[model samples]
Target chain A: MMKRSAIAFSAITATMATAGVVQATTLEDVKAKGFVQCGVSQGLPGFSNFDDKGNWTGVDVDVCRAVAAAVFGDATKVKYTPLSAKERFTALQSGEIDVLSRNTTWTQTRDTALGLNFTGVNYYDGQGFMVRKDLGVKSALELSGAAVCTNTGTTTELNLADYFRANSMDYKVVAFEKADEVVAAYDAGRCDVYTTDQSGLYAQRIKLKEPDAHMVLPEVISKEPLGPVTRHGDDEWFDIVKWTLNCMLNSEEMGVTSANVGDMAGSDNPGIKRLLGSEGDAGKNLGLDPGWCEAIVTQVGNYGESFAANLGPETPLKIERGLNALWTQGGIQYAPPIR
Target chain B: MSTNHDISTAPAKPPIWNDPVYRGIFFQVLVLGAVVLFGLYIFNNTAENLERQGIASGFGFMNTTAGFGIITHLVEYTEESSYGRAFLVGLLNTLLVSAVGVVLATLIGLLVGIARLSKNLLVSGIATVYIEVIRNIPLLLQIFFWYFAVLRSVPAPKNSIALLDTFFLNNRGLYSPAPMPQPGFMWIVIALIVAIVGIIIMRNWAHKRQERTGQPFHTFYVSLAILIGLPALAAIITGLPLAWEYPVLKGFNFQGGLVMIPEFVALLLALSIYTGAFIAEIVRAGILSVSHGQTEAASALGLRNNITLRLVVLPQALRVIIPPLTSQYLNLVKNSSLAAAIAYPELVSIFAGTVLNQTGQAVEVILITMGVYLTISLTISLFMNWYNKKMALVER
Candidate 1:
């Protein structure tokens, strides 16, 4: 009887010990799972969306695939989970999705309170309104009691209320649960106006049946610095996600692209040598191979290539790099220099 | 002969494990022990995990200031209030939405359910189509279609179509006058409560009179008049002081009125319509479950169609309907969590997302949310169970 009780007690203790350890090397877990669970926005054009063949491609998807490439040596190792703004943070914290690259704003509350760590800003956006062109409303201030369709459960909704209130203009708000719904309602004439991050407005506008009928207003309301986020407990996983964005930014600054990364990796430039693993074991420090940065650039293209492919002027979304351009090019797309 | 006599007259206390009476007690104790130990293990692990991460495991986060901003709430709040206050606001909103949805769904569901059984083919067919379409589709999809596909299509404020002089319809949501409370409003409120109490007393008296003397009274209509008339009389006697803050057409939007955001509108409409479909089916099944012989007997005894339904069929049907209806109510309370999807500033968004991120207390934040839901579900269950026991058929 005593032996039986002892066995039961030991079993209970063992289970507790195993369960108490919250997070370990998330990289190992992702590798074992064979795919990185990537949280993405719902159908943000150029940021994340499914092609006709059901394959996801976008600026945001590249971030996920880049991380996957750095971890598992394969860029195709990603499982995309589409999330709205409200679902994005919980999904990250609850371990529903490994990394959230859904153009989520890094707010003070989110960074400090939500048990989440924003790795780095992937996109810098601002709250802006988009309206049908035939309305002849050139500026945000031109409209007084404008009925606007905005996303609910987001900072955008609050910002809209504040902007209209601060301006002392009376306006009505039509709030929707999803960005797609807001855009759809705007298209269907359910809402007189729609507001979101400027880039999102551009992407949504392109998806409209009457694309030319809408124009994005020039007034940028709130500062929205969007980035990838991870749960806070796992430092190793945090570093991996953080460095992936850094790699993209560093690669872009170093002029590395899918086409030219091979040549640069072999180049005699000290900066290139250090970054491409030609000089030292910087890759080992990150628990990756020396060619980790090289693989990311050659396989996924640098940040500039991704931006141009997804939302650049030549693309269907037709967004210009006014604020998104590289630091050297007068935009805010600058990163701390690679050591 | 001796061995046979010994077998027949042996002691009634069987072998140790073979005693069925002790066996039952042992099984119960074993089951109880397993459950207790399981719970203890989860508690221990959770405590250790919290300690390991240097995270404080408690409801202390509730007292901490919620610097996060919430978009739409039924109450006023600032960025510097305790998180507990925000949680209370969320709970109140959940109850508000659920209560409104339940009342609306019941009215519609009963009408549609009865109409489905109507003699008129056109009316029944319309009701049937509504049931088949709504019940077959998912609740979430219905919410999406309402918010995204249907409500989002409203025109801009400049193009807002006028609904009478006092209202306008645009994508922004229905706009109407904000109720302005006048002086002596408190007296009117008191009069309404007193009138409701009077109706309850009259209903009990009517029930007893009918039982004793087999006499009928128009209790419902009388109660309605008293409840409504008393309030109306008080408002008038107090100088009819309430005024309307009418919505005025402004340059780009409506001004000076209560605005219902489109998210709330869509969610309320979708939840009601979808849940109403199920409630209708339940009502239909319940009414059908009552034997047709009872209806035949009531009609054969010279009862009117409405009288037979109200007197005989409804009481039985309610017994069947009440249990399932209560479950649906609980489901609605839980499903309001979906409001987080559209940014409605409910518990999940504010407490789970904002609070969890701000504090880095994953287990605590999620557990609190889970606990809140569990409490809501369990409270509803307990109340409904008591009601069920009261209504359950008793064997003679």
Candidate 2:
């Protein structure tokens, strides 16, 4: 009797398993849901953070907006899910978010082992250290035997360990799971040095009680190519999200700002015309309307515009575009041609 | 009689559905089969989904190097250690905090519970207020208050508060002298063990002598003296085979010795005080469940107040206390997981939070963590049940 029941149970499960295999495409799922679910950081200023009025704005946030514009032609059709460092990849892999636009580094292990793919680098960053002025530590070499505070589950933690071990320095680590906790611990003098990406160091310095008291050290420990991530299987959705970032980068190279994109669409330059969707079939290749790039450029602006607005000199972070400028502008930021 | 026996024995069996014994067995078997099928379906579905997602599912990740640093570890762990060693480090840290928290909470709970029943109005009132306030507030908030508000307010390492030129207190940690054993320390250890064994034999003999002669012996005082004197004599004879290493200021912080990080102090304080409140209530209930007539009976037999309470009331009250006390202990162990929030590097913080994220083997890591907690809780339950059985009343 038990054997017969087991066979019947297996049959039922087989049917259920087959039924579960028929899943809708991510883009179609997003369209049906009427919004793109974007995973962002809990709060990292100039990357992805909320204002007092609850409006999200950042370079990373603009990536999500651009993707939403490319898909739905309305930048506001994106919902945000704030995730921590440890929870971000799981949130994307478990299908809880349509796209992960958080400031996540593109590492070999994460790109290959995990069921995720990095579309492109949005911001080129490197791990650095920040110390209080009173500590009088000018160079990274002077930071021997210092206690370092950093967020857990990030490349920064491993880099800090490697740097210290390579230099034969004795140091202690006080790793927290949240960025805010690491800041709090460092601010409370629990650690002598606060380490993260250089851009993050500048961003978090403003959150300190006395921002002027701390200074970033002159050390770039590791290459941190921060980018958006998507699940590995869906090629169509991945192409759309990937090209959305490319559209912004390409627009910047062609001097197509959001303010000038409307007028520039009628230009005689074939490159600008093709990029603005006035000449080529770029949007159709990604399964979108012809005016998809136009919507993205109009609503979320080009890459330079987003950078200058969120993380430029006028912002509290005052981060100079050292390694994040365009390739023609003496930095490594480059994108392929629209054609 | 034979005709009646035939009528009773040969009454027709009801239909199998109407028969209670057969029907019960059939339903049980049916439910058991359904449960087995449901479990199999879930297991198969999860495995299939994980495979489809391109995630490697297994315990192989435990062999990889966990290239992250933990803030605190009870075992010898470094970034070069395997993920399995990291798990052990996290487990040991969790056990260390939980064990210390249980012992401290019990001590505080017992004192407060007895104080609540004291004759002095001030004592009872204070105990009542402590229980009410602590039990009413949330434990996480209490942890935050201790970590951020109290411990972090201490002076930094540059201006550490030094005590007796040996210990120092700072926001980083409490640093003190660590004992280093010399070459002849083994002799001292042997002497201490021998003294303990001798004390146990002496205690048994004293108990028997008292039973026969109706006289009491001061076994506790003698055992305490021998425990201290034997070790001290051995140390003196061996030319004092111990040295103290004091923490001193190095570059940015103290360099060597023993340091208890503020995260641990805050977590231990929060866990002990919060769980202590519930234990106080349990202890109070256990004491109150004992009848007042038992105290009166002891006093009528010429026993003093303290002796009556200890010998008569407390012995009976403990039968009620041990069962509930076991639950409070289990709660303290579970509540130690909240240490993760304050960065204590316990099992959940370092293993589940950091290791799981680094490896991206969420299913395997979570299952292992859950298995660990289940094992710890079941062991506590088994030990407590055995203790409860021993304390149960004996009947003639």
Q: Give the top-scoring candidate (TM-score).
A: 2
| lDDT tens digits, residue span A154-196, model 2 | 8898999999989989889988878988898889888999999
Q: Report the C-alpha lDDT of model 1 over A281-338, residue by residue, as the tens digit.
A: 7678788888888888878988999999998888988888887788999998887755
For candidate 1, the clash count comes to 24
User: In order, what fnat does every candidate score?
Assistant: 0.31, 0.59
lDDT of 1 by residue, B336-374 (tens): 778766545567756665555556566777887899889
The weakest ten consecutive residues by lDDT in model 2 chain B span: B48-57
TM-score of the first chain of model 2? 0.94
Score every model by TM-score.
Answer: 0.82, 0.96
Superposed Cα deviation of residue A71, candidate 1 (Å): 4.3
Off by over 4 Å in 2: A1-20, B1-9, B14-18
Assess the local accuracy of residue A45 in candidate 2 as a C-alpha lDDT between 0 and 100.
96
